[model samples]
Target: MTLVEGSGCFVVTDEGVRLMDLVGGIAVNALGHCHPEVVEAASAQMRRLLHTSNLYYTTPQVELAEALVASAFPGRVFWCNSGAEANEAAIKVARKWGRLHRRGAFTVVTLEGAFHGRTLATLAATGNAHYSDPFRPLPEGFRQVPRGDLAAVERALVDPDRPGVAVLAEPIQGESGVNPLGTEYLVGLRELCDRHRALLILDEVQTGMGRTGTMWAHQAAGIVPDLMTAAKGLGGGLPLGAVLVSKTADCLEPGDHGSTFGGNPVACAAGLAAISVITRDRLFNRAAIAGDQLKEGILGFRAMGLPVADVRGSGLLLGIGLSEPWARELAGVALQEGLLINPIGAATIRLAPPLVISDDEIELALEGLRSSLVRVMRDKGL
Candidate 1:
């Protein structure tokens, strides 16, 4: 049935109905589907130069790197294929950084309920057991600390047996139902990492690139991570990711790491276009305003006794927790009603509408949720 055909915020299927894309490819399509500027840039770059090995530098890659560095990152950028690759690169940097000081400082401290990527190392870095259980006995040295527990983190860092190399965490646990770490925790983490000489690695793959109303989610916490894994919205639907490193964390010397198609001209062009669209168009501000509207809309629905438990998040990345575990069923109802939304887990429904969604589109999704909830309640005899 082609589940979805044609693009933009709305898509059509073999069923011949248009559906709004509220998930944005799980927060990848920053400009939405088939954006004219991105599409044209990609097409032009592809027709001119598709890809080149990293042995030789490409203009688009260098330009994109320069842009990222000039921005808040102001450091080296390592090109990669996706979020997993970005995290992989970051882990390597952290490990290498640790090895610089001494041996066995390879342990990485992660938080519970954090999702980094699907790769083996990233999977281990991810705190969720379900994802890691399938591939048990993962790479060693990844330790999970209860999120927001400063004492656990302190012990991990100060362990005399082996020094902790880095602290890997997501500013907000997106895949684990959008659990945001407290800003106080982040502040303390920065201070702790500074004291222990451990790098603070933030997996911003899901929360970066203006998805959280700020250019990066950590900006809200007033801390800068040593390395930031960026993806989801970087390529504007193209397969692209980056490991943004601070000057001190730039440990990957030339030839230390490289990717064949990491900085393909087409993907780089798409990334440049995406960043241009995000910065020039002020999508961050737009997301902030839209997110506030959506949050208020969700809170209003909850106040109406819609069974919505807690509505929280900044910007377009909002998570709605239902009083009952009806999210799985409600997702189907929303899809049937021509609105595409995704449930993060059994009880939490995550809504990440495109940064380009209009006021009317937001209203439509709110209404769709209202209708879907009614159908769910009716079926459950609530």
Candidate 2:
């Protein structure tokens, strides 16, 4: 779809149809499309400075790094352009740390159904074979275990001859479907990583910046990871990604990694603005409350005798499970009805609207979803 213009929670297409953007650009537009604060900050920065070699530090870059460290993670932050680059840097961190700290150990343990990035190494790190298969001979040193299976993680980490360096997994696998790991598993994963001396890498690429009702999803579990990657909504709408390392695991040395447009001052400025709104408005807490409302509404679809089988995920990041493989059809119908959502796998329709969306907007989205499902069912003669 070609979007010509956008505002908070809505996008206008070239065809003149306005859509309530429940997808949030796949969970990237946290404050909604073209949020005024974010746009103003980026515009102001673009006036003074836009891009410069990383040879010199930019104020926005340093300010964001400081803010992140102060509230989120403690170690240094590596700037990047997208979630892919963030995860790529994360994998590199694991590889470097493994070689330096472990007995040349470099394997990264990943969870099944995880989607890290499209980059070759990150693709290999991604557990879904379909994404990695197109590019054959994927980089080695990555292993996959079932999501939330601590015993499997333990087994994957126990190879002494080729020790594991890190375990990278999403707290909730967003792309495959909204499959959430239990809080128990998340805490257990941290403990397992500690026991194995392996870094725990939480890919908050889709869940960070108040998406999961927390600044960082790992925070909700009350367990700090050795390293983490965040992007998606970090820049409000701009392309900005960050790899946050803990103080003890801040191992990336100078000359080890760099990105040409990694921390563009303009993007960092937008990030600062987004962070400001997120913090000042307490969007994290707001997301938790709003998410509960949304999930409750979706679950009500079943009571209405819709095809909805389940409602899953935390915060605004949610997926509605259809009893049949009609999510793609329902999404198409919803788009025609001016509601935008994403279908993952065969049966789940994912909704990742802006964190600042109103309750009325949630009701609107729910209505659109219900209408779409009803229409699709009728057409299918179900």
TM-score of 1: 0.97
Residue-level lDDT tens digits of model 1 in 251-306: 78898888888877899899889888888998989999999988888888776778
Q: What RMSD value applies to candidate 1?
A: 1.3
Off by over 4 Å in 2: none
Q: Which candidate leads the pack in lDDT?
A: 2
Clashes of 2: 0
> Which lDDT value does model 2 have at 227?
86
- Tens-place lDDT per residue, model 2, 93-167, is 888888788877899999988899999988988867788787978888998888777998998899766568899
What's the true lDDT of residue 141 in model 1?
A: 79
Where does candidate 2 have its weakest 10-residue lDDT segment? 65-74
Give the distance in Å from residue 374's predicted Cα in candidate 1 to where it truly belongs: 1.1
